[model samples]
Target: MTKLSLNRRHLLKAAAIGSVALASPAYLRRAHASGGEVNIWTYNNFVPESFKKQFEADTGIKVNVRLVDDQGKQFNLLAAEQPNPTVDIMTVAGHRFLQFIDSDLLAPLDTGRLKNWGNINPTFSESDWSTIKGNKWGAPILSGMEVLSYNTDYVSAEEARTWDTLFSEKYANQTAYIIQDMMSIIMLKMGYDGNMVAYLDKPEEAARIVEEAKQFLIKHKPLVRKYYDGGAEIQQMFVNQDIVLGHSWNGPAAALINDGFPLDMTIPKEGSYGFVYTYNIAKNAPNADNAYIFLDAILSSPEIGAAMTKASGYISTYKDASNHLTDLEKKSTSFTDEELASLQFFRAEANKMKYGLIDPAVEAIKAA
Candidate 1:
């Protein structure tokens, strides 16, 4: 088979067989704070950790930040908890907001206390995935996009944008695939309509698109060194000359180049996938007022927000803060100015298929 065809098959097989595919975790009991605490569930290095410091300094609400294992699992866990939850707020993808809200795990929000709510960029305030129903249920702070990156030592930026070259038949098994659960984005990049994935994911039309992409990945599977789960590992692999070009988050891609790795990102002339995280209040939050205060306190300060932006490699939702970013970072902020104007956020009703798609893809690979 041609290398590209093999790569497609491998990708499908990996998605079908991979085990990182997470199912929504169920909650058996209500976990609540014992005192004047606002427990938060967020990623290890995102806003929660940085904001926690400022929040405690300002709100005196005694912030308790918990690192959840991962986004998919976190959502499943919250879904299980339902009426009673362990967290006051959980940082998850904005697209998944309604899934949680509809499950009744989130509480209605009051932005009145959030003086800086106006600072949020209009895109997020009404982005394709603002899932609070009629009222705002989640607060958006920072966002980034998936971009193509290449090791300058091996390839040029111009050449990195070509998925065809990256998954050539000659280098099929020598390639690497990302293990993050964003196969939809990959499929989208392969000439399929991701924007219409909501209607397409289950339709026979999508089958042609998916099968085409699947053939591409599986054909290249034998060439892949191994699938990577985190951006850090992916960066390391590139730095070590393990791969020439790959798909990765813009932050780490830029960081590698900023930190002096022979790396650079490809600003797809055609655009790329965009994504964001939202802060959702748990239904049974013990410190609702404090959470609101903390949300406002952190998001309002453009300086602090910009600092978080620099540290996290995401574009701040606050336009004022984004303007303050260095010209270089602004051009490279989770996106090229061109990409920000072009790429669409990866949005489809995040449902069981959203999570199920991962394992099924991995299973498909194993079967192959």
Candidate 2:
């Protein structure tokens, strides 16, 4: 597990200066005048320092950030702190929200409190993951997709458009990917629906499909150089010329491309899985009002969204965020309508069974 780190010193310093800022007679107050702190737990780089400073400056709300490196770890910590979570807001993936909801770790959002809520893209706001049962549990902020990426200097665009390129004899030992994600995409390439929830009623069919994908991966195991876990690991592999083709999250590959690397990513002919990351207020948060204000500030400006996208390489959820992006930034991050339509967004109902089948299968592939 990745070590979890907290920026307590920064939070302490912010708190120390809070009284001084409040004492200023000329201090400007924004739409929400509640002056308090909002403690956030999110992945590194997901929150830009510039945005954080700007948010504090504009609203006088102190932002205390804690960096969580692993999703499972974050969930565990939140569970352990139940009923009195230290985090006011945290980032949760669309597919993983169900577990948090079932555990009663999240608070239902009152969108009426967020004055800039209308700036959210309908594609995200209308998703089943965002609205559970009749309550809005989270506000979608960014999205990323699994993609086929390759070094353009070595792999042709035509070759990189299909998942088969990773297993081709021509690129043996030159490919890499996260094992579970690779298995999922291979299933899609094999003409399966890739919807695990639909197979829950028929566990036998799910088992059969998973076994097939497992066997296929074992057969092509020699073609792969490594099965990586994190984005940074894969990015470094590409930089060191250890991998010329691989499966990757669009964000890491986009960051490389934007940095003038001879790399590019595609959705592939078989389509791919995508997920939206959202900001949710914790249940029984001490500063729920401040959390609402923080969410509103994130949605209130296209420039904030743009800065977030540039920092993290994820597509922003703000409707007009792209207006502030450069052509290359847009090219690396934004998807066309056709491409968007081809993606299968991760579903909450499928979370358990999807991992149940895929996890053991991946371990078997690794062993073989």
Candidate 3:
């Protein structure tokens, strides 16, 4: 029973801040039949230790968690295991979850086994992101938007609500952007002068538009204090007052405030990137029955959702989790369900491909 700490520095580093590795531990190459224990693989700092203990206490099934360094590695691990895999459940993001489903690496979830399946917000439960062709692949457990986060002492709510604040000369050499998720930066660049909607509406121009966003980033490089890949690095910059505004995911921003920093995250006028984290059952799960038990445990109780949010700094997907959040936690993440679903964002596949090009462009510009 390794107790993993959910600290800012540790979580960001292990979150695979940018990409995934092609290989995983060799021990997981083959599948085995159900044993007394259930093996789960996921990113670190997501589920709290207490929750794992409680789940065991309730079901009497010992849980073994394997930490994944990157979200990309989840698929790589699955692809390596092939027909039979030892992992029972994995935490896959919506985009990667789709790929898992397409590859037949995921099993159709039996909603009848999930007591709280009916309680999930209909918006997520009914969406194609979690369900496809009458089969549900996973349960949406965490949700959040990559919002514009800033130090309140330096930038007020009014000034920080727009994308302009990031590129303004007032904060020249004092702004930072997470280069890891280049897609979000591309969207920020496209919306800089209000050209995002027009650009996205034309998919054929994705390459050209992305190039233009790279050039835009280069143009504002002078204003940027530095480019970062990990959320914790950006959080450290804020704590040291090295940056006033930058690109940040909601969880890390929330973590900052909880640590006593005056940080705030908001959806910019152009909109922010929204994502859903899912718990997927491996197609060749060793303990399929326990997988269902875990999913039901998370969704059926607000306490579980609250614990997840408190540990990961992201908002809960469970509808009833709102009853458990503190006033401060609620204020840190102010996005509504409509806003999360309505944000003009790119799909994970598209975003991943765009970043392939956007990454080198950023490097070249930074060198220049």
Over 155-221, each residue of candidate 1 has an lDDT whose tens digit, in order, gives 6666666555556654443446564443555566665565445543465555555556556566667
- Listed per model in order, the count of residue pairs whose N, CA or C atoms clash below 3 Å is 46, 0, 1
Query: What is the C-alpha local distance difference test score of each model?
Result: 0.62, 0.80, 0.69
User: What are the per-residue Cα lDDT tens digits for candidate 3 across 221-271?
Assistant: 788889886556777777777888888878878877765577777776667
**What residue runs in model 1 are displaced by over 4 Å at the alpha carbon?**
1-35, 48-51, 169-175, 179-182, 198-202, 269-271, 334-342, 350-359
lDDT score, residue 352, model 1? 44
Task: Please give each candidate's TM-score.
Answer: 0.78, 0.85, 0.77
| lDDT of model 1, residue 235 | 59
- lDDT tens readout by residue for model 2, 1-368: 11112133432232233211111112224244566899999865577676677668777789999987556678999999988889999899888888899899999889999878888899899866688879988888989999888988889988977788889999999999888877778778888857577787888888899899999999999889998877777877887788888999987787777766788888887789998889999999989988887887777767667767776778999888888778998999966675676688777687678778888898899899
Pick the winner on lDDT between candidates 1 and 3: 3
lDDT of 1: 0.62
Candidate 1 TM-score, true structure as reference: 0.78
Which candidate number would show the highest TM-score if scored against the true structure?
Answer: 2
